[model samples]
Target chain A: MRQDRSSVRTERDEQFHDFVAGRRAALVRTARLLTAGDTHLAEDLVQAALTKLYVSWPAFRRADNPDGYVRRVLVNVLTDERRRVWRRRERPMAQLPEQPGPARDPATGPADDALRQALRDLPPRMRAAVVFRYFHELGVEETADALGCSVGTVKSQTARALDKLRTALRPPGGAAPHGAASHSVVLRQGVSS
Target chain B: MMDLHDRLDQFAGSPAHPDSTQIDADVARGRAALHRRRVTGAVAASATGVAALVAAVAIAAGGIGTGGVGADAGTGTGDRTTANGSVGASADGAGDGRVRLVAYTGAQPKGFTIDTVPDGWFIQTDDNYSLLLAPDRAKNPGPNADPSRDPVYDPQSFVGKIGIMLQSKDAHGVPEGTTVTVGGKDGVLVKSRPAMTPDGSQPPADGDTGWELYVRQPTGIQLIVQFWEGLGLTQDQMIDIGAGVHVHKDAAQGVG
Candidate 1:
């Protein structure tokens, strides 16, 4: 019996290792979006999620959609961290400057600035919904599953978040920013259904 | 002129070249967590009532003794030497290869107080919720510097600095880390590993070896004192600093 248990543990460990090796980069990518370009926080979130995933490997491996399970865990960790930070009531840093436009990131150009700021401005759960639906290209149902929210909530949050992004990306003097025409059309398609 | 979705995809960016260090750290931390869970489970299954509580405390003590840099067993006299032969017990000043701690003379912050701070570090920001300490360097703006001009040096950035605050309300039941004693009160210490990529965007990599020590206050709130990895403080020194924390009654309870 002990041998059986040991062998089971070994098998699970090997599977967990493979899962981590394969999914870590993508996980970090998603986390980077969730954290709105805070690389360290993104990495920390991913590591923490991965740690929890490792502990629940047997159940995770048995799931019908393991990738969805992984996404859920990652989102959970991110929101949990945010909740802790909020609960502590001591913000490490002030909110990004209350400028009209997005904060500058050296890695991105002026065009990408607005998108980054728009995402940062969203509440954590709302931002997660948008990232899952748009960046990860997950459907609303999948996004809702990953977010542990109702599909209706996902739609509402994504729609509201996209509206904010649209406004933020709009150019001064009421001119359409780059790709505004096409994006407006896409947003119509994205939110209507 | 990219579509918004395309723009977001670009903004999210591609993952960097894989780092084995991260994967390895994940597995190691996972295993440690599993081990802890199993130990706790076994303890719960084997005891009941006060016996279980006593066992839990023993387990915590044993875990800390084995998991951390071992209990200092020092006199708490402010003079014992650490493994590196630096004064481990002294919170008053730094020694060779040791972080210096000096009596904090700044106006008392709203939330917390400490008897000693690392040498040359100053209270950069004093809010009801947190106290920030930054090194006294030219580049770092003095306390209450304008954020408009020096966003990087803004105390709220919390980058490359020490932070002291009360633990979040939700963290009350969570076991923070290895147990230790600070000024005769129980404390917990958690040390974070260095980031795989030391990019400046990260909080601690600029010079922090992340260490967070939580000392329980008489009011039952845990006062958390965290150091940037860059400070290079030994565990003994961390305890010494934690020993000096006083959570003011006015310190607001963290919201959750």
Candidate 2:
């Protein structure tokens, strides 16, 4: 029993170990972003998903797409958490996420700051859909899968989130902030309201 | 689709991974649990009772099952006892009705509706932080000996309250099963069994010592365990300790 036990255990755990070694970083990063820069909560979410994966290892091992399975588990845990009342009761941490220092594209300019602030101010659910779609750049279906909702919901939420951002960041006079660049987007997206 | 795709892709540099060491450690814990359960030595009756409670728990947990407690007696208690070191022996002698045990403590200093609790009660690891509980009832909400009525919901049905109920129970660890009468009805017992090494309980010719646990949730449905070969504590002692624990319901858990 001793001789065979080592072999048997290795056979059982090999796939899981490989998956973690290869994909752990990506999963952690996604969890980090989803948690809005809370590294600690992100860690908890990743562990929770991975722990569940271990419990259901038999099924997960044979699944066609294990990464997707893991991602689905992560998002499911998050949304389930959102709906639970006790989750609402805990005190939020006092730490602040290191804000992305200014948009990388100089041409995008100071307006990007206002737009980003507007986006961050949205409700968590809407923000998640928007961030997954725009910032994370996931497909509608993928975003739906991650958020455990339908594509149509994602589309509408992203659109509404965008419209709100545009309105929030819009210069009061309906003019673009300096660079006269706002004129360029106004014509492109018909933002002439 | 195209516009949204553009935005999401901008940050697709790559997702970061958690440390490999962390994942490995968690996997190790899970595998260890499987082995620890394997080497346990509970007696046949207690083992049988544990199996029944597990089946009931699985049902309460919303998993596939044969649907009732009758199947527990039919299972092979010997093999199962060795598989799960503890015996679950908390079944009720009471008639059909629902009973719940909720414990609160001095944790969460900012929250209200909190009460003080005794020390040393072991909360199930996952549930330690949750203050709300939804105790799922086993298939046999009452004693198998008396089969007159059935309950409507099990603890599994109390899904939304997992975090809160779990926390309250976590604050106080249960060492023995203590029964009490609440609302003038016979209350069930709540208790815990301490950590036992793999070699502690070995059945003599298909017998070994094992700890006991009893549970009935979402009201009625009780399970009692007897560890291997009578070497461990009796079902009666388990109940005595279980009956001593106290449980109170919250508006969230109590709500329909």
Candidate 3:
């Protein structure tokens, strides 16, 4: 509904173009992470989000921080575009789950493999929460604001998301409790905090 | 103190730049939508909802595979506690009760209702596929952006992508225990360890295998049942829910 974007009187379409052109890669990457590294699906998600932003660009441009508006759109598209499927025709001749470790080839790369699995293990929302919070380092309030929720909600999502990440990344065994919603677990790269 | 999460989050990436064609294409889509209407006073948008559904499920059901997945029907989707006791619920509202499927309004054929998804949770569906999105906020957020509009880019660039495999299956994996028919195809249900990966590469040998239920629902379409991690339910639990996969006998008539 570009018409909807036309409806908004404030933000110039040129300004919006600059805005989109600038953030294109980031939006795709974020969508990629949310879609568990599915680049094909990730592109679709980004396209969907851009369309939404185009519809609301005028109104959103008037509001504070249009980038945040678009960011919300990107995240929402990934979260909302849930029914994406990739089909495989092969019967169950023999199947293997992709290793949590790096692949033999360099293109797939070790970091990419590990990171992909870790991200894939997260629930969509939790994944969004993690990407938005930790990757973007958005504050609870900012994350909530971008996501159109309260700060408290952001806190709990972050906490729960951290727990899920821990579960996925941790060796298959028992781990400690995630404590309470009031606190958040700050996970570092090689060493977990 | 360093906790499990801290180290996990720190699982850093070896950054390499990805091409920007998709961004260009996204921009083109938005601009085309805008110019189409602006130039022609009409907009013929690509509602991939239904098309994507057909492709997603059909291709996904027949997705690339080199092995059979071991269905650990005996154990869990993740940590056992995360199932019942874990997965902290929203303290507000009526609490973490079961979700109710509200109305049907996707691009799919008419007259179908699955289980009740929670409120606040948005529905993302096509003719053959569907997903209940729990917003990063527990409040169940709405769709991110309007499909018909152009997106404003983030300066940071499209750095990553996320993939989700929503699977449903009986104890035996697929076609054997439970069946779900969507669209018009009687898809042969198959469940095996999905070879999912992020970098466009295959997964390792030891990753947790998902229970999949494959069927042909739409015209020339198949269905694949998968979820985020594992669905903590047992074989019995999955069967219980899978029993409700609504199949319209008449609609599924021509499906092979």
| Reference-based TM-score of each model | 0.52, 0.41, 0.42
For residues A143-164, could you state the per-residue lDDT of candidate 3 as single tens digits? 8877787877778877776666
Per-residue CA lDDT of model 1 for A47-88, tens digit only, reads 788778877888887899988999998888886676435222
Residues B1-256, candidate 2, lDDT per residue (tens digit)?
Answer: 1233332333222443546676676567546644544445344568889978887776776655544444354443431222123443223312322121234442432211333121222221122212322223333356453322321122222221222232222112333544544324444433222212211212334333233333444444222221222233334433343443333442212110
Question: Using lDDT as the measure, what is the rank order of every candidate, best first?
Answer: 1, 3, 2
All DockQ scores: 0.19, 0.15, 0.05
Residue range B1-256, candidate 1, lDDT tens digits: 3465677666666665456676666776776667666766686577566776875676676675573223343233445554233444444444554567777887877667778777887887767677877777725567877766644366665556777877765445534568999989988776543433211122231334366787777877778777655565667777877787777776764543
Clash count list over all predictions: 9, 64, 89
Taking all chains together, the TM-score of candidate 1 against the true structure is 0.52
CA lDDT of every candidate:
0.67, 0.44, 0.45
Which prediction has the highest TM-score against the true structure?
Answer: 1
Each candidate's B-chain TM-score, in sequence, is: 0.54, 0.21, 0.30
Among the numbered candidates, top lDDT falls to 1
Q: B43, model 3: CA deviation in Å?
A: 9.4
